[model samples]
Target: MTETTMPAAPGAVPHRTLPAGALPHDWRAVDEGWGRRGPDFATLSEPSACREYVALHHALGVDHGDHLLDVACGAGLAVELAALRGATCAGVDASARLVDVARVRSPEADLRVGDMHDLPWPDATFTVVSSFRGVWGTTPGALDEIRRVLVPGGRLGLTVWGHVKASPGAWALAPFRLAAEPQVRNQAAMTSLGRPGVGEAVLEAAGFVDVRRVRIPFAWEFADPATYARALASTGPAFVAIQEVGEPAFLAAAERGATAHVRAGLPLRAEVDVTGFLARTAAAR
Candidate 1:
């Protein structure tokens, strides 16, 4: 499919044209949001999401000599693990606080704070690019950036939420959906790749081939409703909620939603159906 450029809407946020290492103003919220959750994300989000990273690395046949870049790499745990396994790992994120933690985790790895739309690297610098629960289908420009940074024929791995209807913890999105902007809510819904063939189509539009999607069991388990709620409220989605309704109101609503999921005297558990997509760029021209 041919991709067409669209003009920006009135008052739309301008694209980031800052130098590779400079921070974009629009990414401030992203930085602050993820930064606020820096510590917890390592313990809470990474545990569940790291499975996808491992799965992607194995699928792409990543090796010790390969240069791998993890975009929106929060807290750097995935990069640290990859480096341990011998891959020359690097990562970039909008959150400085999260990047700090990642530095401690992977001190030798090149970790930077930069916008995903304008990654900090020369073109075609990486053999593999991985983004776990980071890039959304709606952000084709970000995909283009990923494509630009990858060596020709380099592989890309992305994970997005699967069909929410099929997810047991779909209700966890209520606060975000209720409180976020329409665009943010739509992005959070993750409807694009959930549809048959849509994920492959998006990749193809971004100059990728051999696009494939694989289902993975992604889940989150919390020992208590209150703790779960607090953790949930720390993510990007909850950032939108907190901005809309303030942290106190957002936390109350999150707690209510989380408490509803408590079952069988067990901790609050959410079976998040996640899909990982893999694709390769065209060979270097």
Candidate 2:
């Protein structure tokens, strides 16, 4: 087994370097109601991650007893599945609120609130490392963290959000047409995915190899306009931002727009790009 540790931060820590930890920033504001929506994203996110897990298990010959680390493990989505699969699973995230929810949602996990740049564990601590729909790191810190923890021949499994050009993950917004102006105003307040392959290039820079990419095309379905509107409002970052612009009027309008779309019987399909990567360890001499 090869041992590794997250690389040192460029300048210096206010304190000494910590081991594998979660992100330093707070994320609870954006992720608080993550698992409470109509469809359990907790369940949706991981099974979707299963394809990559299977790839790693097949390519690297993973053992059920191998330790697995789920990065940015919101609401224990990947945590529960890892536990169910018989791996000794742990999760790390920047949001303590989400971590707490993850712990309650999947009591079987070893969840921690720490930064990917400063993981809490020692070297060669995990056999498999995985992350789901997480925000991009400002630096290549996560890759450094991953390399540090994985053993020789250790595998990496990541499910990344693919770039959408035309739709741009924007179909759900159509149902909320009434709320468009407000939503657009709301979206102005946050960070963004700058462009495509930004993450892919970062993964390469972090020293990962055998990077395989694929897209998972799926539809976000709703029983009706009201349900669809609520579902969107309940979980999405964009939807949340719109509420800041006086939600009462926008919500009412969105509801009517959504009802119109529902009656039109449009499929309302949007494609999501979920890419996976697999790699091994070297330079352990």
Candidate 3:
């Protein structure tokens, strides 16, 4: 948590501090994939997350006095929204390209490109923290880092895709199956936190208190199947599928999956379950 100024990437805002040592190999790989279509994600995919961001901020009571940090804050949409709600905001993501977009969106925010497992802020630097579908079952260690930067009794809000297979939007995500088998397995592990009682157990184990679940509103809407395919292709999961099957194959499969859901004049809509968790750091004794 000690502050050390580090050189910022080209087009990135000056970071508050840099994590010690080289970036983790796994995180670098993740950054490579997600940063592939950064602008497409910023313009097409990230807007759909507005409802989730507003809902979680409401649940956490974010306001003018709060200092907020958004972990894995893709393109800084959530951070921008928080700033509009009058909270001072900061964010971090592994993808430098995505972070560049975020810097443009929220010029004053303390946004950085860094690993979630090793946040660069000093201890107890934030009053609230949020991660929308960012932290996963496979990265529960990130929770320990989240806890480190929150002041006593500080709030935490997180979201994860919930009951995805049973949701109306399942079709929208079906193309992710084209990823190699190991990537598919990793996806399952990532979403495991959304299962019943799973997130609460993990939060408590990480020393968070008052853990509870809340339903978050989420949906994906596209003007047509082709647009849907374009948006999906911008996501990290889709990048994995693209790696295995190639971008053309992945886009074709996504378009085919969405075709049945298309309406003549209406946008193709997919409503998926999203689970939100609200918890707090233990109070100062």
The TM-scores of all predictions, comma-separated, are 0.87, 0.68, 0.92
- Give one digit per residue, the lDDT tens place, for model 1 in 1-285: 000011111232323455644565666666667778777867765665666667777887888888999987878887977887789999987778888889998999999877677676889999999887777655656788899989989989887777876677877666666554674546644446656788888889888898999876666778877777777766776776677789888878878888767778787777777888989889967
| CA lDDT of every candidate | 0.73, 0.54, 0.84
Q: Write the number of the candidate with greater TM-score, choosing between 1 and 3.
A: 3
Cα lDDT, model 3, residue 14? 23
Q: Residues 206-270, candidate 3: write the lDDT tens digits.
A: 99999999999998888889988998888888877888999899999888889888778899899
* Candidates, ranked, lDDT: 3, 1, 2
Instruction: Give the higher-TM-score candidate: 1 or 2.
Output: 1
Q: Model 1 off-target regions past 4 Å?
A: 1-22, 180-184, 188-191
**lDDT per residue as tens, model 2, 1-285:** 000011123532321243443233233333443433424443333334444445433454445887988777766755666666678888876555567767886887788876666667788999888765453443346677788899876777655444433544455544333434544443322112224565556667778766655444434555565555554554444234344445455455556665644535564333444454556556456
**In model 2, what lDDT does residue 172 have?**
51
Error of model 2, residue 15, in angstroms: 10
lDDT score of residue 21 within candidate 2: 36
- Write down the RMSD of all candidates, one decimal each: 4.8, 7.0, 5.7
Clashing pairs in 3: none
